[model samples]
Target: MNKIFFDNWESILRTLVITVLAYIALIAMLHTSGKRTLSKMNAFDFVITIALGSAFATVTLNKDVALADGALVFLLLIGLQYSITWLSVRYKPVKKLITSRPSLLLYKGEVLNDVLKKQRITIEEIYVAARKKGIGSLADIDAMILETAGEITVIANLTDDDSQTLQNVAKK
Candidate 1:
């Protein structure tokens, strides 16, 4: 009976350690990537994330690295992310260096030809976004800006749903 009880206890402890280590590893990996990295996962990001998930899960499930060792590495990564975030926030130059500014897509309903060429955006995309709001012509737009996030913002001449949204931002 004593042997059986000890075996059960050992199994439970091992399971608990694996669970904790798995979570810590995943969280640490995500935290280290920064907010910008998660904005959009391209093909490269999808492949890397899958590969890493497999390796980390195996390391924890197989008990290759001791629970403490995995946890330590995870915590160290988290700490490094925290340090970088703090430094980036405190330093203006660093903040500007990392954060991208919004791109001016159009001014007074006229597309900035130079910006369109620089951003590699085709005229077709501009027409599609305008058409989404029942706008057949770009002349109806006052200003349109594209955020660094690749999101399009259309400032229309009238208060449609799209214009209402932009007006809400101003009202606030």
Candidate 2:
């Protein structure tokens, strides 16, 4: 047992380094991903998160390391995540930088062509989001955003008559 502990020191240290790096990477990634990732946890999101966690675990603790090394990595990741969470809450600039706010998908009764191109999203995708929200035509949509995590958000500027029609469809 004692011999085993000494034999695996390098493996243990490597795992520590890898795990710290991985945790920081994840924190930065999630922070930049925006609130939609947290608020909108669908099936795809769940599966992807699980798969990523498994991969990160493997990268942090290869079989060369003992069980203790893996455990230490896990603990360090948790600690780093906690600290980052606290920091994000305490600092406004950090929160703004980390959490991307919603951008107008459409504004002033027009599809913002520049914004769509900036996101590298196709018009069809925005149209699809409008359709999901019961809009039939792009002409009716005023603004829309392809969220940071690839969720499409639609904004419609409707006249009183149009609002009544949409409200009817939305109720159904």
Candidate 3:
């Protein structure tokens, strides 16, 4: 019980040194891995971000995990992320497997109820998104999209041009 509150000066010093080195290694690895390593673009990216944090915490608090081991773990994760992202960019199947397609929640002033239910989104949430976009009326909303990043994008019904922006969006 006493050890829980105060381990010793050596342990404290070890933790301090390890923490600083681990932090520097993490930052350097992240910088080397590029922006995609820390992106919240999709669920896979989110998972990687969470895993990195967990590894960092383990390195910081767990004496069993050496600084070198933590650095290696960071490298492994970042390298995997980089490789997967690279492959995903070149291969359609890989991209499809790792990422989700955006869903159209509203179209031409009509609410896609089935999509809303399937996506576990409520009409009230859509309304709030529209309001955030400064939309005064539902009739003014041309489309509402549930993006892969879990963001609600409200499009105004001001244009008549047949834009290809919704070409890849899932209508159902």
Candidate 4:
């Protein structure tokens, strides 16, 4: 019963030391891996972020797992992310495989029911996004895009410029 509350001074000191060192190693590796390592740009990136957090926690709390082993795991995961992202940037097939295309939910003030249904998005969510963007009414919104990062981008009906930015977004 006592062990449940207090293990020992040595164990506590080891945990503290390991936590600081592991954290420093993680920060260093994240910096070396580049900005993409920390970006939540797509689902794959999100998974890597979650895995990193899980690994950090395990390493901090599990004394059986050595600090060197934890650092190696961090390095491996970051290296894999870097390689995948590097390939994705240079290859069209890799990019398509790893990420989803942005989708157009509303176009020309018309709600695309098919797209909304396919994406499982509600009309109320669209209204909330539009209102957050300072839109007064649905008619004032020219386009509402569901970005790859799962964010709703509300474009106002007032843009006079050509929509070159939306060329790649799936409109269905």
Which parts of model 2 are misplaced by more than 4 Å? 1-61, 157-172
Candidate number of the best lDDT: 4
lDDT of each: 0.64, 0.61, 0.90, 0.91
Cα lDDT tens digits, model 4, 1-172, are 8699899999999999999999999999999999888776689998888899999999999999999999999999999999999999999999999999999999878899999999999999999999899887888888899999999999886356358878899988
Higher-scoring candidate on TM-score, 3 or 4: 3
**Tell me, what's the RMSD of every candidate?**
9.6, 10.9, 1.3, 1.6
Candidate 1 has an lDDT of 0.64
Tens digit of lDDT per residue, candidate 1, span 34-94?
A: 7743445433334445655655665566645766665565555445544654676799776
TM-score for each prediction?
0.53, 0.54, 0.95, 0.94
Clashing pairs in 3: none
Which 10 residues in a row give candidate 3 its minimum summed lDDT?
A: 157-166
- Tens digit per residue, CA lDDT, model 3, 104-168: 99888889999999999998999899889988787788889999999998888636646677878
lDDT of 4: 0.91
Q: Give the per-residue Cα lDDT of candidate 4 at 88.
A: 97
Q: After superposition, which runs of candidate 3 have C-alpha atoms over 4 Å from their true positions?
A: 158-162
